[model samples]
Target: MDTPIRMLENTDEATKQTLENVRKRKEKFDKFERYHNQSIWATIILTSIFLIYLYKTVFTVYSYSFAAMFSAFVNDSNNLTFLVCCVGMYGGMNLLKEKKDKAEKEYHDLRCEIVDRSKDYWKKEDEWKNRHLVFEVMKKQYDINLYHEKK
Candidate 1:
């Protein structure tokens, strides 16, 4: 079957259309690339939030201030402040976990978009290259620069 590139090269008027198509393809490729970058930044932010919350809950909660506060609050081992802190930490952790999960989903979707846009861009680029080759042959045969020549 005759390809779009071959047809486009055969038609003199198609030069304008070809340039427009290339421009659109590049725009599409760039758009997906931008989304991919944004997704990565979102993932980083979500991951950082999760990590910081985890560290505070597990490690930083064992400081001297926390120990002294607990000792002063209650003589018994079970303290209201400790329970409230743990519960609050658990709720905050769950909230962060949900946000991270959503961010991960968005990241995956952006990756797919990038792949799709890349495939389309490369496909069009190949067609453009083939068209150029055809243009080269025509140029040599006719002794004219078909691309930039006056109509």
Candidate 2:
């Protein structure tokens, strides 16, 4: 089963090459998965902090007047944009991870195609060799007949 497709009865280069490619793709996909997971955790932490800060500044803080307190809260919101940007980057990185996963699936499917094509190629090669052998035998017979006629 492991040695299903080969040129003759010797080597399984097609399977070896396909397995190597699958290994490389799996490694690449795992690397991106790690990065994506880290980014997701970071984004969750940052968003939590942002929400807590917003709640404290908007509700807990007191001033002489509601207008003045609301103004202060609005002024402090300038840094919230940075947190938003961090979350956005995490989302973008997750999209990249999805693309890498799709590529890995494509590479995995290629293994089946490699085996099929290798079997087909070997079959054709054997047929070609048989035809050549028959042609050679016929040519020798014809040459012998010509020599006998000349004699």
Please report the TM-score between candidate 2 and the true structure: 0.53
Judged by lDDT, which candidate is best? 2
Measured with C-alpha atoms, the lDDT of residue 42 in candidate 2 is 77
Query: What Cα-based lDDT does every candidate model obtain?
Result: 0.48, 0.53
RMSD over all Cα atoms, model 2: 18.2
The digit string of per-residue lDDT tens for model 2 on 1-151 reads: 2222122232235534554454455566666777777777777787777767766766566546788667766677554585667669777777977977786566445534533454443355655455333223323432111111121
RMSD of each: 14.5, 18.2
lDDT string for model 1 (1-151, tens) is 1244344443344443443344344445545655655555665565566556545654465456766545544553434444555556556655555665555455444434433443343356556466556555434543323354232
Query: What's each prediction's TM-score?
Result: 0.35, 0.53
